[model samples]
Target chain A: MRRFSWFNATSLTLGFAFLYMPMVILIIYSFNESKLVTVWAGFSTKWYGELLQNEAFLSAAWVTAKVAVASSTIATVLGTMAAYVLVRAGRFRGRTLFSGMIYAPLVMPEVITGLSLLLLFIGIGLDRGVMTIILAHTTFSMCYVSVVVSSRLVSFDRSLEEAALDLGCSPFEAFRLVTLPIIAPAVISGWLLAFTLSLDDLVIASFTSGPSATTLPIKIFSAVRLGVSPEINALSTIMIGIVTVGVITASLISKRASLRLQAEEQAAART
Target chain B: MRRLLLISVPYLWLLALFLVPFFIVLKISLSDTALAIPPYTPTLDLGAGWAGLKGFFAELDLENFWFLTTDDLYWKAYLSSVWIALFSTLLTLIVGYPIAYGMAQAREEWRPTLMMLVILPFWTSFLIRVYSWMGILSQEGVLNQFLMWSGVISDPLMILNTNTAVYIGIVYTYLPFMILPIYAALEKLDISLIEAAEDLGCSRFQAFWLVTVPLSKNGIIAGCFLVFIPALGEFVIPSLLGGSQTLMIGKVLWEEFFNNRDWPVASAVAVILLLILIIPIILFQRNEQKQREAEG
Candidate 1:
């Protein structure tokens, strides 16, 4: 182990504070009893109760849930197949183009993507609703799912699947017996990532959704313009809790994998 | 045949939905801004038998493209968005680099906690995070209140309804983007390079400036591009924080399409924005390809 110092420890503290202070305030304020925001009248769960009573928000949450589940499942299946082809085939024409097209929406200015999609929908005379939202969400999300599953498939030792094939199993049967179980984690991770993205999305969903199909972000957006109420803070706080847990879990898993790699490297050096 | 079938499905979906939408935008940009649904009818000869702008739609005139070029407001919005995005990206790099550096130094157990903290904001709704800053920086908000309480000022600061607010919002939202990529590069860096620099009669600060900064450039560039492009088209952070005083091209485009119901000009603006965005992307891809070939 390397020598530690006050300077290094202090910076870590400061970094964590910078990252989490706003969220801390949000969670704290969620329990504040004041109807008027920014005032800490007292601590209470009144607003969380109020959040429970919001039928519209509940219904909006339901819509967002439907979109997330539907879109993420579709994205996971499509993305996994694409990933398998790109990695297993070793080479293919137009794979890069396909990857680029799928991923473009991921980083493209949402304004451009959203506007273009909106224009397309309106031009085609398609009604803006759940279907449009699902389509737009799935397009970008498939990229993430594909990347996750594909990266895992890339480094995987192929001999295991080949052995299963040699033992009188067909390619499909061998894959079901071997690769499927191994790559299942990647599929789950991709599904989770897509689910969160679809849940948290506002910009694309806004353009594609009709009046009857507002998501949570749209609801919070419209209500926020009215004023800062504790209800908004409460919702934000709950969202922060879920995402914080997810990010921590992902980081731990990745770090553990790297550590395992390092241990193997050290063992090889000894030999 | 199985491989081909696997490939074609995603390809067709992208062609039908993703690529086609941009084509639709391109087609609309070519038409006159006459609020046409599917965009028919060219410019009218008002003097002869008043119809639409047949002159505008004519390939010879290129009237709509010319109009976007000459429009001062459109150009100003474009310029302002670019400048602001530049500043925000630069700011995020400055702040995020140090934090990433410090994280790279932490113990293995501690690094994940730190990374989780960085990505925590990502899990929440982006709009809500931007909205939360509204509470923090508003006139009666925490920032102004702290300033007043500490006698930093007698009155509340006019920080909310200005470009300053937009800057704050952009930096707040995008700092994560800059930090994550930089951290990835820095974390993967071999630490002995620093020792190598130190062994060569370099001080710690000098070692970092000499070795670390150059090593982190690719990540910095990727982070900056990620932040800058999105910052270019950001509507929510600017509008919510800057309020009505902010006239970003995004808002301008939104107004033309939704409020003004002028699809043609709106499409023109979208085309222009897409053109601007595509420049960086093509350049980045080409550079990455070059780097790959050099390594190969």
Candidate 2:
């Protein structure tokens, strides 16, 4: 048996505390009744109420949602296609370049990507609005989605796809009926990643957006540039809550799925 | 035809959106700044045929690049960005290594939950995570309050809007990137190797340094590159946490474009920044390729 030392225990406790303490403090301070952010007067939900009533925050939230949904959906399709080509398609012309393009944006500084995309928009006479933001978000986030999906595709069982082909299915039909169902989890996760990336983006959106559009990050950024505010804290807490719930639920579902699969395999072996 | 269509659709989309924009930035970097709507001189006038193309080529010069060399601010910003990225990457590794080792040493059944705990912060909004530090780092913030209350210090430390805050933010935000890779490496480590080393007359500390650290070198390399590359051009962290004294190239580029409206200068700055990043990025790619090959 491997021994767990006191050193290990202490490190783990301190590490997690360091990681979580800032956000924990922020969450606690969100309900402070005092106008001063640091001082504890009493607990109240007034900041949350104020956050809801702010028209600017509401519109920015709506804009962010629209961009996230539109961009992530489009990114998922393109990214999935890119992943399929990368994993399944044998060597083709410009394969190196194709792969490079897919991977470059994954690590490319957001400032450069945002600047280049903005220049492209200007050069092509495209207006900077929600549409431009969508385009920019889809372009970058697709790279992330492809990375997620392609990793899954790399480990996929090929015989399942080959069997569909043997059963007289066209390539498209085989993919749609067999491969899609199998890779649906990866694709969904890819979509979620793309969604969150678009939602969290500030620099790219800031570069691409005009007077006609503003994302939540941009709004929050401008607000916090001065200093911390309770309303912003409330907003941060809400975002943190949603993400925590989403991540926990997804992990639980996947865990249960694997457990059930393990049970089925054991039963099959027993018989 | 079907295969062709599938390849071409994404290929064309990337060509039009990703590849072309990069070329546009490159071209603009060579051109002079203009007061026009597009904000750069000598834009390609394809309608005028050969003469227009010739004229465009003739008009383009390396002035923007030259300007970058003459200006000390750009040079300082680039140098400072590298310094900050390197320093923060080291800090992240220090903070992350122990956590990764601890997680790897954890009970098998508890490992997955621990992994999820580390990843949960990653799934949350990065901006919010960074912004959360503001309330704590501010003069009247919780850290100061705690310190004063405990008689640890009589005065609040000046952390906000300083380079120290920027370092703290970078280390805080990029900690997971460091931890996850190292944990993956340490988890895959064979316990028997350490036991054998002990049997061979090495102490536990000696075994860790000689056997464990060398084995996990790939993870350490990957994690450092992951932190260093993004942190080099990090915008949000420095902009929010750093004061006027902070001089990262990313923030410089943002200011040049937005506050100064010098798109040509911004493009020039970006071009140079990409050049500096190319070496590290290539090395990172090679490392990833090697790891993938080993795994396969």
Candidate 3:
């Protein structure tokens, strides 16, 4: 089974390098004291220091975090509900339409989605601002959350809930006490996915955002469009660092949880 | 009652926000551009009920959609977007297939780490990834500097602000979308199937071609749709990496709506794009439904 063939090794190495090399270069050059993005000078932390003092970038980061938190929270609630219904509610009226709406956002072009949302806001006389952006973000991101949670729900053991019901637990009680806890990890991951989607969105935010609601991606886009600078490199490196740490921590947590679950199962089997 | 409450909340939200907006776009597309807030007219006044509806219907015209057809720029943008999306999807398949296959073939102990490696970059900021390429592909960028320093070329190659850059940016950003699905499909695949194929009269290449490729067809189609659909409407990559002559409909729509302030035309562009995308969208939905059924 251990096929360490030349072809497999080469393809994997090349693919990973192609995937990772740009970020590595960006991170390395972030420390370069040279003003030019490509040039290498003596290493310094001046760009990072400058980045800290930049009011606009900091404000944009704050706005982005606020939107991400709000949108992901709402999307999680709605998406979790949607997922449960899709998986457990059995066939109902408008099931096709419900499922269609759920999946449509996943593949819909950002331009059309953004444009349509913006127009909806305008037609309804809602001012384009943070609220509108949150609404727009929630609309799209909930689909990702639903897909994540629903997949988990699909293979879920329903007999557990049935046993709970047979033992005098109400359906709601059974779900709240038993089912929700089991699916909590998937729900959490769905929230995280939604949060990241909101944070990373530029085009939709660009369309729905007014003057006061500039997101981090929007700010970064405008700045990068002007020209690449050492400050942007510094900022990007910090972002990459944060994301790497977060992902590693998440994977570690899940790994530990799974390990504990395995230990419990083994103990039960032994008993 | 509880089930109904659960069902209606998300359904109503999507209806109001996601489903209803398209009608607004359609209505706006039919209306003439106006120098007023909300931009297009004649406005549908629900308060006026039937008379207003009749007035709005009367004002509605196909002029904007007609304009889209007549304009060479719009058609070029549409055609080129489809063309670029098609080729980039192919490029991603070529590059992604080996990585996905390798991951699927890797030892179980290392699979999680490999999966994490793939998913980690996907969760990072997409705009920053594209921006990173500006550094790599710009004339004075890293690649050029490295090539020049290594004496590979006396002159820096012009890779940035071209169709080539657009392709690279798209293929790079959308690579994860292509790989993850195929990886999932390949991971679910039984190695014994391949072994059995080999035990028969098939060579390794033949085994892969006959057994693995056909098996992964669902994932490949899903991946292609994932890459091709969004790439068709991609705004950021073409705007950032593509040159002035680059004719992506997303960029065109952005310019139309944001710069030119022509809501009717932009809405018309969107409507047409939706019409074009309807087939793929249905296909994607069908694929998903099939996968769900298979899983069940």
Which pairs in model 2 have colliding backbones? none
Q: Which tens-of-lDDT digit does each residue in A1-271 have in candidate 3? A: 3344678778788989999999999999899988977778888999999999999999999999999999999999999999998999999999999999998888789999999999999888899989999999999999999999999998788998898999999988999987997788899889989998998999999999999889999999998887688889999999999888987887788778778877987997899
Please give the DockQ score of every candidate, comma-separated.
0.48, 0.77, 0.71
Single out the weakest 10-residue window by summed lDDT for candidate 2 chain B: B34-43
> Per-residue CA lDDT of candidate 2, range B170-281, in tens?
9999999999999989999999999999999999999999998998889999999999999999999999999999999999999999999998899999999999999999
TM-score head-to-head 1 vs 2, winner: 2
TM-score values for chain B across all models: 0.88, 0.98, 0.94
Q: List where candidate 3 sits over 4 angstroms from the true fold.
A: A265-271, B190-203, B288-296
- Model 3: per-residue lDDT, tens digit, B54-152? 887888899999998898999999999999999999999999999988888788899888888888899889998999999999999989989999999
Taking all chains together, each candidate's TM-score versus the true structure is 0.89, 0.98, 0.96
**DockQ winner between candidates 2 and 3:** 2
For B141-260, candidate 1 gives per-residue lDDT tens digits of 888888999998999988886889898888888888888888887887888888889999999889889998988777788788878878888888887888676768887887776687
C-alpha-based local distance difference test score of model 1 = 0.80
Best by lDDT: 2
Q: How much RMSD separates candidate 1 from the native structure?
A: 4.8
Best by TM-score: 2
Comparing candidate 2 with candidate 3, which one achieves the higher TM-score?
A: 2
Worst 10 residues of 3 chain A by lDDT: A1-10
Q: Ranking by lDDT, best first?
A: 2, 3, 1
